[model samples]
Target: AQTIHQWPVAEIKAVGSPLSLGCTIKGKSSPNLYWYWQATGGTLQQLFYSITVGQVESVVQLNLSASRPKDDQFILSTEKLLLSHSGFYLCAWSPGQYQDTQYFGPGTRLLVL
Candidate 1:
């Protein structure tokens, strides 16, 4: 069985500051990783996804970038922040099969100012 974990940001941050978030998957090698975001009272959207290490694809037009730095770890970051970026971030994974359902792990909430 695979285990996924997301690291949550536990504080508020100002605009223009750098942001970094990460997630890890255990017991599963080379799993399909995904990043999703949802604003307060807004719809959820997929931001990025990766099928292999060192190859990440952007699914949505967000001002953020995601990378699969390790076989079991994924990272999301941005050079600068914006107020509109405030919301919730979720990390998910799937078995990479087209018919496989994606499973959500954990999420982080951001209350930007």
Candidate 2:
């Protein structure tokens, strides 16, 4: 069984400040990530698709960066937080297959003021 963990269930931050969000997987190694976000009262968007450590693909240019430093860890961060960055951030994992059913972590919410 795999367990996904996300840090800081929610946040309230100022614009232009730096932000970092993290996710970790337990009982599973080398899982791929499909990160996503949803704006307030808006639709969901896929942000990053990562196959392995140091192998991340961007689905949108949201001025965010993600890294998988370890097989079980994924990090998303930005040097500056924009108002547009305020949203619901979700981290999901799969067994490195497009058709695999991805398991989602408990997500983080950000409110950029």
> What is the C-alpha lDDT profile of model 1 across 46-88, one tens digit per residue?
9998999999999987789998989888998899889988889
In order, the Cα lDDT scores of the candidates are 0.85, 0.89
TM-score per model over all chains: 0.92, 0.93
lDDT of 2: 0.89
Tens digits of lDDT, candidate 2, 4-68: 99988999999999999999999877788878998877877989988888888989999999888
Error of 2 at 80 (Å): 0.7
Which candidate's lDDT is highest?
2
Residue pairs clashing, model 1: none
For model 2, what is the error of residue 44's alpha carbon versus the real structure, in angstroms, after optimal superposition?
Answer: 2.1
| Clashing residue pairs in candidate 2 (N, C-alpha, C atoms within 3 angstroms) | none
